[model samples]
Target chain A: MNSRSWFRLKQNAPKLSMLAYMVLFFIFLLGPILIVVAISFTETEYVAFPPKGFSLRWYERFFEYDAFVDSFIVSVELAIATAVLGVGLGVPAALAVTRGHVPFANTIMTFLLSPLSMPLIVMGFALLFYLSALGFGVSFLSLLIAHTVISLPYVVRTVAGVYRGISPDFEESAAVLGANRLQIFWNITLPMIKPGIFAGMLFAMLISIDNLPISFFFGSADTNTLPVVMLSYLEHQFDPSIAAASCIQLIVAVIGLFIVERIYGLDAMTPAS
Target chain B: MILKRSGITTVSAGVVSPWWIAFTGLFLVVFFVLPIVNNLLNTTELATLAKQRPISFYYHKLFTDPYYIRIVFDTVALSVGVTVICIIIGYPVAMFLVRHSGKWSGFIIFLLIAPLLTSIIMRTFGWRVLFARRGLVNDFLIWADILEKPFMFLNSASSAVVGLVHVLVPFMVLSIASVLRSIDLQLEESARILGASRVKTFLKVTFPLSLDGIGTGFIIVFLLANGSFVTLLLLGGGDLKTLPLLIYQQFTISRDFQFAAAMSNVLLAIAVGCLYLQLRLIRRKGVKGS
Candidate 1:
């Protein structure tokens, strides 16, 4: 090779190697999920990787299975309820912590975000007994309350992070112009932190829907979530239908994240450092 | 007073209504705080009813029982192993994301986060498929002449570690990258100008500076791995018995709520301790940064 080409290759070597490493990293990250998607289409009774042939038999199986269908609906309903409840409780608490002139705001914020740090299985176990004692009895109400608790921190943290960035001067001016507290919040603060609220709500829904350990504790025929059902099913059987169910769950997550990326950006989703 | 004529009672500009705190606080107290408190109470009550002194019963069981002792050791070992593996694998990736990938950063981040958003069960299922008896991993090993027959990769401690590292590396990467991003690039440039090699500059400047992120990542990963059992449950093949898995078994099979609560209290203590360390790290970083 020419001297110029040799010099260029040497200069580019580190970048090329880093690039190669990143490629492998992604493959390691994405390969299993891709394999599941591939397996879901296999024209066989058993799960296969380099899938024998492409077919939608597993998808058909997913639809036909009553437990999968019912649990999916339950998961979706629980997620929506969680988003509403989490946002309702979290947004105001976040506002209070950030804007309410509360004493020991830092301590209060940490306490509010404490659920994110707690082990979910422990929380589930605690709630199972606590709610049952309270007459919730492993029902849907019990599941909703448990889910809302875990998801509340995401809503609070995201909203608080965004609200902290916004200038309070806008609200001050609006108040001076005779806007009432409610009016000021609805008109000025609400529009600005809309992205945070949306991102937080989306996070709440995704977390609620994807949750397994917490949901694992509340599994009745009526209260079972998709993940809980899938786990029990996998414990007994391994079929391509499970792969299809996984892919469906994955699609929901991708769509949820895609919207967050479009609206708020994923980088901001990192837990408060 | 002037706004009273217009029925717009003037309030302090940033002061949210106290009702907000009352409402949120009450909900948290009932659902969040009460459950955990109830768990503690139930543990003590059950201990008493079992004709053993409440606190001492658990203490005795924990200190004397070899099974419980082994579990505690295994949980800590697994968490430490996972955290170390994550750092070794994740640091370079974080460096690449922060320093190397200029325009591809957004896409790279999405790749890092998508798996996290997906259900843990689904991710574990993906690993299941890969580590199945006749799975791709075995097929490839045999095809490459690495083994005469397929080795059992699933339901083992090593697979559990691999599965956990895959799940948690993103957190570590993001943590280290956030700190790495804040670091002044010119320091490295100055190091290079002063005749330091790239390796030497990274070792002396970049790595030391990123220690905060490493600390943050270590606590976060260790905490998550410590509490986690689903990966162990599905992939561990009953060989790996950690505290969380034992709690699951106790609650589900034995219906021993009190014993499960006692075990979970130990898990909770470790988690809360980790959180304390993490928050202290963040506060220190905040103080230094500002």
Candidate 2:
């Protein structure tokens, strides 16, 4: 080839390499999850690749075991309670930081977001210590408190994000027109930021359900969360049942994310800052 | 009557008040701050258990113990390794997503976000299966004539790192992609018009502009990898131990809360230190960018 064509070929070579690399990288990331999903449908007793004749027996077995069923119920209930408590605490806090004249607002926000950076295991271990010191033992209440604490930041961040998006002009206009504070918040602000609050609530609930490290520390003989139960079960037996259980979580998360996307777009949830 | 008062109108009119702040503050202080503080104090409490044993005893035990020290090193080294690998692989993905912002980008972003939202235990379980002796990876290699038999891939540090990088690369991609999306396309076009090659323009303009995202993604992945134990716990076999795993064992199996509390405090300090550096990088990035 001529010099000019050779230069063009050189450019295309690196582009081709990059394309190939990205494809391989994504495959590395996604191939495992797909394999597990594929395996969950296997008809065989063992996890067989190319999954010998798909069947839903493993999923049936997942429900057949009472422990898995009980733990699944606990996870759902805990996540719901966490979402409720998270919103109850987080909304006011988000409002306080964004609108209220709270002293050191930035510091307070950092403190609230601190858990997002802290290691869950350390948080779990520390909670174990703190609860015992306060004469509270590991129970469902402690589990709820832990889940709520971790979920609070997501709620606050997302709510504060949407709250910031709303022009203060509308609320100010409402005030000028003689609407009371509660009336303005109830009628104008809440309606406008409803998508954000819903997004945050959905995220908080999903994360609570997916949580394992903190739940592992707080789980008792009778109060194991689903993820924790799956973990302990895997420690002894690696079966298609575990794959089915894991798929249930995967399905729930995907649906929750799709709903969040539908409501407010996942792009809105991305922390650009 | 309270709403009618104009003197307190500004405070009341806004959605938040001191009471709201105080309420959330109290909950955070009790549940969040106190637990961390309790761990700190428990370290001291363990130190004072006997007159002969002092605070230094725990410190000496922790720092001097070769096994525990190795765990700390292994955790940090693993995190660093994972972070480096993520940035290398994630930068291209992020660049692709940002530059090709259309139908394909949406699907790609969904692919990235799905694994992120999945349960950590499940994700780790997926890796565990892949690394198993009879897993797909080994089977594929054997079929390709790359190996005579399935090698011992499971429970190794490399396997654990593969699991971590799989989970965290998405975060790295998302962070960098968001930053890249904010960069003006005109900058690249301008550079090309000025006779710069594609590689030259990317190196001189694009890469530097995206450094903030790189820094942010690095710290986020590193801190998370350091804190994470599930990947290691489920994927790591034999004597492989990370700081989190050690803390877990101490707290649960040994029932050594004080020692576990000490280890946790140490880990917390490391996390905070990384956060401090990350904040500095962010501030620097902001100053330089603007």
Q: Which parts of model 1 are misplaced by more than 4 Å?
A: A1-6, B1-15, B43-55
lDDT of each: 0.87, 0.82
Residue A204 of candidate 1: its Cα lDDT?
Answer: 94
* Segments of candidate 2 deviating more than 4 angstroms: A1-16, A268-273, B1-15, B43-55, B285-290
Screening candidate 2 with a backbone cut-off below 3 angstroms (N, C-alpha, C), the clashing residue pairs are none
Q: What proportion of the true contacts does each candidate reproduce?
A: 0.61, 0.61
**iRMSD (1 decimal) for each model:** 2.6, 2.7
- Evaluated at residue A220, the lDDT of candidate 1 is 91
Docking class of 1: medium
lDDT of 1 by residue, B21-58 (tens): 67888898899888888777774345554445466577
